[model samples]
Target: MASRTAPFSPFEFLIAWRYLRARRAEGGVSVMTWISLIGITLGVAALIATLAVRAGFRAEFVDTILGSNAHVTVYSAPMEVVEGSGVYSSLMRDYQVRAERVAAIPGVTRAAPLIRGQVMATKDGRSNVAEVYGISAADLQTIPRVANPETALGSIEQFGEGIAIGSGLARELGVGLGDKLKLISPEGAKTAFGTSPRVSAYTVTYIFTAGRWDIDRTRIYMPFAEAQSYFNREAGADEIEVMVEDPEHLEPLAVPLMRAGGDGTLLWSWQDSSSSFLRALDIEDNVMFVILSILVLIAAMNITSGLIMLVKNKGRDIGILRTMGLTEGSVMRVFFLCGAFTGVIGTIAGVTLGCLFAIYIDQVMSFVNWLNGGGVWDPSIRGIYELPAKLQGADVAKAVILSLGLSFVVTIFPARRAARLNPVEALRYE
Candidate 1:
């Protein structure tokens, strides 16, 4: 008699496709197949979306920090200077030459000297400690968002003895533009009755919001010349703040900065200043990745179970094919294709859903915030008021590959079991 089975060339794939599309009555896909597909889809989507959110948060945090501060700061080492009047002063003097040299460095974009000090700000009998930064108007523009004319009350040049305060700080002190406040500095003139803290009054010339609560609540900017006179440091600014073309590559500029600044000058990068915080963020990202990967692993297990059930269901059909001269390897390939198809389809669906979710995450967060009366992340409590999400192509690719790879690997054992089945045993009852 002629063989009943079709040739292996296209028959194996054809049979697999027919089996996948077949109805329940025709011994086609079972409920487990759908369940496994859903599992994989959810797993991949969750991983991609979660990773994108983490990356976004890290990027926003770094930008906020760098916006409020310079990429690098060069300052003279602490020195005890005895004035002509024999009064002792601890100051880092005369950084103009150092600033010029640092500005000439390859990656340096802008360099300006600044005087930084702490002072108690008093208004309406309410006192709050604040950091004072004194820089020229032109140099202040190079810092970051402060450069925008709309962000400040007016030009830095307009502020003679006046100061620019952050919006948060202004709100806290119950002060506004042109309002006068008292600033008490610890470095005071030597009096016969012990040293008295120097108290000076300054008009708030401008108001700025750096979008970071820390900066907005605790920082004030003044003119470099006025700050020098107020701090009694006629020598010059305390440090030179340097902006770079790329803040991420700050390490490469350190060597040249140090060389240019010469002896006693210390170069501090933004990374060095925020190392602990960045490390904490990195740890959080890693922990989240491991936790979310468990979902994908569970989905892979579902694929395994689904394939095993499929092999059992097709046993009689396999036995018939074997009797008709179908090779064991061909039988294995048929089942493998079935499982691989489910995996590939699920992975693609998941990738599409994940990318969509990441793209619209901001809007979702805003809606949630609105539902919660906008207190989800109060700017006063948290520096950032909104959740951030960035969709990276590499992250999506990794998630897709991982899910598909796991699915492919899990099919091997079940496929091999089907290939090793005994034709007579499978057909004995049928």
Candidate 2:
């Protein structure tokens, strides 16, 4: 026969489980047990759900930024110097060859010449400011969100014929496919009399949403040749926008990029340009985690209270068991099992619920939007069009560890008191 099991073997588990499941006319023990279970379940679920949403939102935010914009921008100064202005033009006049050289780098993916300008877009008496990007048919295909057939309403092949505006801009301007949208450029041909504004009409051949409110509300893409003529950049491009295989590890490529981009060319990465914005996002994530930790602490307190009441109600049972030669350590283990049982089961249930919620958040948000009569989330204010949630293993593990640790730590004090209770006094009081 096997050696006898330790004091906390099946005997302790059975006693703790019986106390947990025992029925009483007063309904105190069962009520406290249910409350503890529910509290722990809700706390863990809330923590997991909050973390999933933060992770998902961060991912979508970064994707929109990377998809709509270049990871790196190479600016080459023009040889022509302005007299008495003390300013040098940062235009890459030889952009064609510069783009070829940059694209050949090991990690470089795509390098395109771009001419960006701000203009006023008007249709049906409605007007909104728009940022125009002049890109080639081939280059436009590289933009993920715009190139995706699902998010884009029009064809990429037809992009060369007319201007492609964002979905938000089209909605705000009340313009549709094939409609003529007037573009008013402040920088026009300089004349002897004065500088006159250039107002031109272009058909809306394509419309797309970059999954970002600001991008969709303002960005427009024009044919490379058309933009060159319209912006008076026939000889050079404003900058060379470069894409790479790995945007997060762009530091290692700085020397290679600079060398290939030619002398006096300054390179700026997406991270460098958006340092403040990224820092704020980090702070927000930390604050959200800290706020949810309090909910878990409340659950810990609930466990402590329930176990203390349990010890009082089972005083007679403890006295009888102690008189029968059961050790104090065994009594402590029994009550400890009770608290740990509640935590383990509640955590498992909460993990399941939270994971399901994160996985189906899109469908859930759709129902919510429908119930609210179609305008629940405003992308312009929140940055993204829809709410997002992403489940991470690290977040789940952290929540589990936090819940179990709290359960075990809080049970110690209550268990100690039950063990120290005098058997004679407990029996006499009963």
User: Whose TM-score is greatest here?
Assistant: 2
**lDDT by residue for model 2 over 1-430, one digit each (tens)?**
1134486789889998888885865378678777878887888888898899988888888888888899999987555456777667777778899899999999999999999999999988999999999999899999888887237777878997898999999999999999999999988877997878889899999999889999999999998788888888878798888999999889998998899889888888889977788788789888877877788778877888888989988889889988887778888999999888988887888788888888999888889988988888888788998898989999999989988888788889998889888899989956
Cα displacement (Å) at residue 259, model 1: 2.8
In the predicted model 2, the residue pairs found to clash are none
Q: Candidate 1: lDDT over CA atoms?
A: 0.81
Candidate 1 residue 10 Cα shift, in angstroms, is 5.3
lDDT of 1 by residue, 279-336 (tens): 9989988887777778887887787787787778889988998888778788888888
Residue-level lDDT for 16 in candidate 1: 82
- Candidate 2 lDDT at 134 equals 93
- What TM-score should be assigned to candidate 2? 0.93
lDDT of residue 112 for candidate 2? 96
Cα deviation in Å at residue 368, candidate 1?
A: 3.0
